[model samples]
Target: MAFPLMKRYFDPWLVRIRNLLKAAQGRPMALVVLFSLSLLNLSSEWPSNMGRPAFVGALDEAVPDSFRTARQLLFDQYQRHFPRIPTAQPVTIVEIDEETLATVGQWPWPRNRLAGLIDAVAALKPLAIGLDIYMPEPDQTSPDKVAANLPETAAALAAALRALPSHEAILARSLRAAPTILGAAALDHATDTASTDLRSAPVLVHGTDPLDSLRRYDYVLASLPELQEAAHGQAMLSVTLEQGVVRHIPLIMGLRDKVVPGLPMEMLRLATGSSAIDVFADGSGVQAVGVADVQVPTQPGGDIWLHFASIRSTLSRYVSARDILKGTVDPQRIRDKLVLVGLTGTGTTDMRTTPLGELVPGIEIQAQVIETIFEGRFLRRPTWLKWAESAFIMAFGLLIIWYVPRTQSRLAVFLRAVPKGSAVLGVSLHLLNVLFCFFIFVRLGLLVDAASIFIILSAVMGCFFAPALLRGDDPIKTQARDAQGREDENDRTGKAPGP
Candidate 1:
């Protein structure tokens, strides 16, 4: 009985929709809806995903640029209102801050002093130490290098200086003392070919090659050979910016035909004593990165959508390098914690603009990534949302194409005074979708693209109503005007007009 009733009501609606589609106006509207669906990649074979051929990829990005920007704005608003609260207490930053720079002397401080700093932190027995700072070149202050530059007359002094161990050796020994992960930088252009052999944590790929999905670098700027040998792990410290701002940080990337983990991922591996990083991917892209018992969800290209927090949050603790070196730092702050060491002084720091609309130290971002992974407070874009949005746009558009013109005749008086009421209805439906997206984001940490829905709906509504709006008069109003004009003419001529 219920099925029969539903069909009785629905069959006529279906027939009406079919008739509407047969109309000349409805044909173009249907085509527009299909075009919008293509933009959202409803068909996978056409636009493909992010790493397609250059022109095709740009077309894909260009079409959805506004949608992406609006989505980012929504994300920024969400972040401001309810940023992720940092719950991983064992992550800390050992900052080489302004005070440390002033106290320990300017950067490029002799490697031995850096060694002392590392030794001090190592003494606290941190679970893992990450050097977000890099030493791409060997220290020029090494005793032998200084000795080689001196005059021959100062051979004895040079010999005495050379007799002592080089500062680099001291630093290398310090690195060995701690389970330290050294930083490497991914470069777009080839520099020295020597660093190609830089050691990296092993990455095990599962299901399909992920090279296309991962960010690629032509070369790498690795640390000194001795330092690389001493460090337990070496990983890229570089980050890819999104529209000149930092949003998602890549967890794994392609470097010189090799897959390597980023700084935070390596640190997590070291902390957990994980032997290797596992990347789970499909033809679409990377799904997640596995480190020991923790599985971290990622963007298709192995990037994690960084859940930002206020800089003042205690999600990660910070301690001054000077204090650590001076033994004034609390031991408890470093005990069993994953410590990231980097410069935070102005002019020498790695600054990134976060979604929270603040410039943050890159090391702090790494800290947040580590905490997010461990605590599993990830913001994800579900794979099905594009299809969901596309279905919504098409279904709502079909409804408008069928219902609007039919209602116009019945609601002539109300619509004539407000021709834009139809457009207003479209906007209200859009707002409802936007609010639903917001609710999903708040309740489940899912990032939905409200902009796509709006864009498609706007196009459909504009096309549907443009002809009526531009023509300036509909048949009903024209007839009413004609009747009124005949009455005026009859009164003027003193003759009755035939009905």
Candidate 2:
């Protein structure tokens, strides 16, 4: 039969393979089995990319100190890269620092003083000025005076949100001249319950109660409701961090089925004239909103990638309220700038953990958000990435098995074949897909561990096939290797060695 004739011609290869099978006997199958399980486990660990609590908790606990240090490094990198890139909107801060506090009196200065500060900032004609401080109530009660009875104490301590109207009046005047955006935090403090008369923006932030960690925020007490009502956008100033480190932020949250940007994000979007900023969900990866022909950069989960400038120095570099109030700073400084108002106090604990494993300052995080929105450079790892990884892993592993063993020497063949063929091909493809978003083919938005799967499958294939090519001799089997070496020498020299 033709089959018999083909087998007769390829008998040497068949013998080598059979010999390898006999050598493997019972030990080689474990690699593939274990590898498959690992792949499955990895897939489940990050399913839908929402991130599991157990895994996040594990990372949090296992790498506690790592978070802060990592954030610092990333922040430094961003600072170095920022000026060179020339972002459209430069981030600035109008801080209510200790010096300003001294000039204007201690914490919660009189409503008129803040109102004057707002007016001064407005005079500079900045694009937007955000008030990081909350105005839940008017300074009706003088805590320093110390009230006697509980009822009298309650009455005296109850403050009106005088700052709201004050800021609104200032904003309205300034808005007529230029653009402006104000900040408001979701309520956790008791002060927000006080003012029914103070106006609030109609839009609200919405999110689920994940472990009730966020349940504390019940409402948003804006300093200027009337002004905010007329403004182009309003955003949530809330930020949750891991171990006091911030790495990522919510671009938008569902509040009453409407999409408004988060504090920094909204401000940046408003500054750039983009009404609808698509904040890709942790669930959806990345979806294009109704933007016209605009491409976006994104993280693996399709959100804007969080990057930061140096937080430590940023706090010190703040433009004080005193400067703005005194007319020393140019309106041009804030003119057309995207301003973010966030607390950097050590006592505050809104932090997040990131890949760099750091607890970054919340304000630095806002800076990152502003930068991303304006630059339009987002982070994304799309779906075709997943299929390409699976394909490359399978093909490269199989080809490595099929080709390398055909050479006369197993180790040498492995090294050469790996460089020229499967190994290089696999590694190159892997880096491209994971790092640069190459497999834009499927657009499915999934990714796998190319290096991991390849390592595992390669190990299995090596066990199954390589030994067969070098059968009748393993390097460790001295007697077999010696006999094969002798045969090889004879063939090369055209004579047997004199023993």
The candidate that achieves the highest TM-score relative to the unseen native structure: 1
Prediction 2 global C-alpha lDDT: 0.48
Misplaced by over 4 Å in model 2 are 1-38, 41-89, 136-232, 239-245, 256-258, 272-285, 289-302, 309-317, 345-360, 399-499
Q: What does candidate 2's lDDT look like per residue over 11-83, in tens digits?
A: 8886765565434331334345444534543443333434456755565455444324433443333333441
lDDT values of the candidates? 0.78, 0.48
Question: 440, model 2: CA deviation in Å?
Answer: 14
How displaced is residue 302 in candidate 2, in Å? 6.2
- Please give each candidate's TM-score: 0.84, 0.57
- Tell me the TM-score of model 1: 0.84
Q: Write the per-residue lDDT of candidate 1 for residues 4-54, one digit (tens) a residue.
A: 999789877766654464356454655666475545443332322434566
RMSD of each: 10.9, 12.2
RMSD of 1: 10.9
Error of 1 at 221 (Å): 0.9
